[model samples]
Target: MPLATEMFEGHAINRSAAERRAATLTARRSVKKLHQAAWLVNAIRCIDLTTLAGDDTAARVRRLCAKALNPLAPHIKEGLGLGDMRLTTGAVCVYPTMVRHAAEALEGSGVPVASVATGFPAGLMPLDLRLAEIRYAVTEGADEIDIVITREHVLTGNWQALHDEISAMREACGKAHMKAILATGDLQTLRNVYAASMVAMQAGADFIKTSTGKEGVNATLPVSLVMIRALRDYGAATGYRIGFKPAGGMKAAKEALAWQILMKEELGREWLNPDLFRFGASSMLGDIERQLEHHVTGRYAASSRHAIA
Candidate 1:
């Protein structure tokens, strides 16, 4: 669809109400024992296990890929009766230069390699340079490209500019899927978050991401509620189901359950799939693995035992 400001313009988001609703999502729906294990397993499938640091290396990316291939330890998998389940993370995300390493390592495993491109973490570069970065990532064998949107466009109410920028980046992605990072923390208000989300989806973003993890705040439930509502409204209008990712500041098994619960309640069970939802996390996997191990052994394992990379 084209840029449609009418969909989100003047849309009112009550922060207090959103916060109240988000709070209940976790408190009211509590899974225990086997059900909890099942949800955690499902969460593993929706995780975009990521490594996007300034000092990221090919070796580090390879190790990360290895973890994605076999997230749970053999003992934990066996204890849980997951015999040859072939569980793997939804994808492995990395810097553009590290895409080749992840692509080669995850080849034949049915796992996609996602690259954070278009001047990721802060898309402050020239549009041409950003588009070129996307092309480079695609040429490097990235199946998905995570592009960051310019916060200024949202802050200054430049919907046309924001839409045009993301649309061009989407074009540059070619055959690869594009996840537009809204960087909602910098957008100030929940209204801005909703508007940016609508514009990103209108510009053909396969997924609308909450943050880049470098902001002062990232992936709060209230902000996520606004984005999820925008996603629901867009689906209603266009009949197109878009994905959602809440990146950064999510580092616990409980947080994973909360977000999954949010998706299940707000968007139906269909959104629980990796194709529609994902957690952009690195260390969160460790916590999830730790919790699973405890569920199996009845004793909490040392955090080192579940180290991701």
Candidate 2:
């Protein structure tokens, strides 16, 4: 199935050139608001955590990035409050090299392993190397694989090449889920994000993700909205329920809440499950604990309640 370009069926109807342009603009803007709602809703409501701490520990960022996710993954929901919101047992993520480490850290727990691959943050490696990395990650017990597309392909107008590569990566994930990271910051346009989302889905990505957590454009609501809308249309057309993952820059519980809202408006109840939605963060767990505590006790816990792996 060549990913359907008919995602814009309703908006792609025959019309005057001006009308077509207006519809395109209008559709883009509408898609824009759906994402805005994701952020806005977060400001209002709930999560696991969404921080990578890449900046907080420059000296130990590499080791810290691997360790930060450990405590959260061991017992994500263990310390959760009795309040209305929910959280993961732990949102465990690790470098590609540690897929097994992450797998061990999360062994019996329900927490799943999300391993980054494909020369992430800069999908410039040869396609053969990227697939091998993905295969190794999945074999090492990664439940999910996050791979980056060739940003150059999307920007330099080599979309066909990009599409072909994404298809290969998706097929490489025999069972584990595939999350295609757009690195939307590099694309620099919502229109491009929308188009890329469509291409990724047709190519077989199980989830459409934002960013690579490299101090670049780490996940934005608007970017998510565009992708989700395309996914929504993709689902309606193909009956395929794709998933979404937002990584980087989510550190607070409040931000998680907004993502919930974004899911509601764009993807709806069909995707509220952990299978359909997940957030990737490095330093977000402990803070989620603190936020949950604050919501209940009026005053925050004086000490950190985060569990150490």
Candidate 3:
């Protein structure tokens, strides 16, 4: 290809991206201008409370995080052995310290590890500290690092601050994939999630994970729906097929399946895999087992629950 031709192609690509973004905004607004959800689902998600039974108040809150896989490993392994049939390719994401636990628990099991960092649930710490945490986790064998955005800054409309944090975190990822968590519960609006998705993708986020699975309100179908749409729009502009993950409070098999169905319908079969899509679930694994077993076997097994780590 000629140098001028290459340059022209790049410009055309850039312009086309801008137009797509513009169209998305117009479409989103038009849809919202007339139709919007009158209510948010107040129905409680089936999150196992054991995660919340931590040392103190903060520890208890942190415990609400979905890293508790020790109890659910065998079911996951058995479910994987079922082969060629699953609602979706399932993987377990745990905290950094628990990576080895999850790794050993999932050995030969094929499920990947996604570690939380950037002072997850509270990005009030220094950027260097956050980046180092990300680096250390990857070094310790994390397949993915789920870093929360510096919401204090992003919410202030500091796009540059937001961009730089994501850029640096992405660099710290090394060989591991980077999943930028917007923690949409804290972001508080669809507009914020949409814009944060754009910023993270441009800054090199490998995947745009929706929450910390902290039960902090970040993971919702609608919130994930918005972020996925934004990621799709950005990919059309920048040629990066950014991934999407809705991690928190996704405990029921039906809920996870609904998300998967939406993902398949919107992003195509390519996003149906664990690479581009995942449920950061704690209690949903057993449900998946129940689902698969009931389908493959005649009767559901009472032993379908976690084999007790």
User: Which candidate wins on TM-score?
Assistant: 1
Report the C-alpha lDDT of model 2 over 256-308, residue by residue, as the tens digit. 66566667766676566667887776445556555544443456665446442
Winner by lDDT between candidate 2 and candidate 1: 1
lDDT (Cα, 0-100) at 14 in candidate 2: 24
Estimate the lDDT of model 1: 0.93
lDDT of 3 by residue, 122-241 (tens): 777888998888887877667778888987665776777787778888889988888888888888656677777778888888888787766457576667667777877777766779
Model 2 residue 9 CA deviation (Å) reads 11
Off by over 4 Å in 2: 3-87, 303-309
lDDT of 1 by residue, 1-309 (tens): 778789998789888999999998898999999999999999999999999888999989999999999999999999999977989999999999999999999999999999998888888899999999999999999999999999999999999999999889989999999999999889999999999999999999999999999999999998999999999999999899999999998999999999999999999999999999999999899989999999999999887667556
TM-score of each: 0.99, 0.75, 0.70
Per-candidate clash tally: 0, 9, 3
Candidate order, lDDT descending: 1, 2, 3
Q: Decide which is better by lDDT, 2 or 3.
A: 2
Model 1: residues with Cα > 4 Å off, grouped in runs = none
